[model samples]
Target chain A: MNITLAQARQVVAGALAAGRAASYKPLTVVVLDSGGHVVAVEREDGASTKRFEIAHAKAHGAVALGLGSRALMARAEQQPYFIAAVTQTVGALVPVPGGVLVRDADGGLLGAVGVTGDTSDHDELAALAGIEAAGLVGQPD
Target chain B: MNITLAQARQVVAGALAAGRAASYKPLTVVVLDSGGHVVAVEREDGASTKRFEIAHAKAHGAVALGLGSRALMARAEQQPYFIAAVTQTVGALVPVPGGVLVRDADGGLLGAVGVTGDTSDHDELAALAGIEAAGLVGQPD
Candidate 1:
């Protein structure tokens, strides 16, 4: 499955709009394709300088592992060394709550979206909004 | 002066627009702070898997050296071993023409932008466009 550039834009805009609508701080959002490559990214005004990088890392980790970063975060707690190895393998993987896998209606993996520069819960919520806005399923668990 | 996240997004958007306008193949654009850290990145759909890495390498080389990758290319010709060492020194410094130094109106270094997925000349042009669109200067040399 592929994410068109237009859809990628919608994901970024949707994420930003969700953050704004929720009254959260400015955020950065990123989308990665199935192969764990960036498709699009954006940082809202006043987002921290590192927000974009964090967002990308979270998305990369999720898509590369075929699981949401929240799952990774939980696994990391059980096996720190294994998680570190996974991070090394993925080269920017972040086992955190803000990354969610993007899947099609048929449950085929499309990609992932990540959000940063706010509370982890808020970040996850915005990412879900982004994925849904693009007509994709976001696994929030 | 510090480069704001908002301006970083501008650079990313401008670079992608330049690539589209030039009809270059799908591209990946990246921005790095002077400290060799990611600010923003984007890879167009259908772009090669390595485009984002190559783009980031070029940008890191430019920001770290305080010169365009074109200059680094020329320097590399005179000292091949040194350039290779430089590449190792910088995590992802590709001594090629795709990277351009970013500067402010007062000539203060801000960061750099790199473009991949096209000819070196075309990549340089896109990176320059990104810098210029953000009202930042790109030192092509």
Candidate 2:
């Protein structure tokens, strides 16, 4: 099933709330449909403006490559030139841990969520929290 | 005060509601802070994937030039080359009516709201409605 706008909002809210609860730096959250189109995005009041673009790029990279950004990070380490080419081709991409794939119970692709703030690992945890809050599974790898 | 994520979401919700109430096609709404950075963006399910980019460009142009998109459209008609050059320099800009400048009571620039889906006029109207719904001023011209 496709992720609806409502669910996307919930994901964003959950991610931000998680960040706040963890006392992380202000976070930006983006939810992208399976097609890599933006469903919704929210940048916290004090978050750096660039966080929005970074968050979107993370989600876009995950959806476009059909792999969680964590996996992409590993690939980038093994094939830096390839990841660089892909980033150039995609306009914007960040091979990092904060981008997570969303799936249904049967492992159907739904969409993806990207969170940015604090540490990358903390960002990924918030993303997973958001996906679960929206009743979807988050695949970080 | 700056436009918070909460207010940006309100603006997007208001714009989409306005479009639906007017029986317009699916719409994409984007909110940009005064720095021309994205604050929030939402694309309706049926909106074309490109709508997000269009909407962001519209708002970006407004925030970048300190003029509403309707005014930009007029300038474009008078000096096509200037507008074209600016678009190229800015990387992305839409000199159309849908981009609206947002302001506070004292005429302080707060941000901008952009909407894309229906006719340019309808899009501008929706953007205005959204700004008003969020208790901010929308300068369409």
Candidate 3:
């Protein structure tokens, strides 16, 4: 399933809107194409400056591995040695939560999204809103 | 203008929690001190592998310039030549929106937070939430 840049941008916009409505705080959002290239980005005022890179990295990890950051974190816990080795081999493997895979209506891989700040759960919530806005399905809770 | 490691951890944890509650795919959150040093990090399940680096880069940009990533993006657009030169000078510079700066109640710089995955706007929201949870103010929204 091809993920259109337009859809990704919509998702990001929706997520930001949701955050604002909830008064959750400023946020940084990122969208990546299926190929892991950055499609769009947004950084709210009052947000930290590093959020852009962090969001991209998280999205990149999801798109590259076809898995969420949470799963990677679990794997790291189960196999610290392997995770460490992989970390060394792959200079950019971040086993953190907040990265999610974007799937089309038919469950085909479309792209990925990453968010940071607030709680992981909150970040996830904003992402979920964005995915829904994009007419995509996120992994089950 | 000093950011403590404890504050960094708090920001990350809060961001992670927010993401989880929202049922986002997964994520990685990171906090950096004013000096652009990593103070805390967390990776959740299903998050992307590259989030670590992205987070670092985003936060680095915020701290380095004392501006939000979105502002930086504007600058990049207005002066692509200068941005290109800056990127070349700083190998890790990514002038995208998603990073935010953290400040104290008195408006003193504390550090920055970077997030990845969903969208730049979403990432910024999560970071803002984390900063608020840490009892600090994000820059003016």
lDDT against the true structure, per candidate, is 0.84, 0.90, 0.73
- Residue B140 accuracy (lDDT) in model 1: 71
Candidates sorted by DockQ, descending order? Answer: 2, 1, 3
Please tell me which model should have the higher lDDT, number 1 or number 2: 2
Top candidate on lDDT is 2
- For candidate 2, lDDT tens digit of each residue in A1-141? 578888888898888888889999988999998888888888888888799889988888999899999999999999999999998888788998999999989999989998887799999999998999888899987
Model 1 Cα lDDT, one tens digit per residue, B1-141: 556767887888898899899899988888877666666777887788778889888888888878889998999999989889977876678888889888899999888888999899999998889888999988977
For model 3, residues A46-85, the per-residue Cα lDDT tens digits are 6655567666766666776678867766765577565456
- Evaluate model 3: give its lDDT: 0.73
Per-candidate total of colliding backbone pairs? 0, 0, 116
Compared with the true structure, what per-residue lDDT tens digits does model 2 show for residues B73-113? 99999999999999988868899999999898899998999
Which one wins on TM-score?
2
Worst lDDT 10-window in candidate 1 chain A: A41-50
Candidate DockQ scores, in order = 0.49, 0.83, 0.06
| Per-prediction TM-score | 0.89, 0.96, 0.53
Candidate 2 docking category? Answer: high
Angstrom error of the Cα, residue A138, model 1: value is 0.6
| Candidate achieving higher TM-score, 1 or 3 | 1
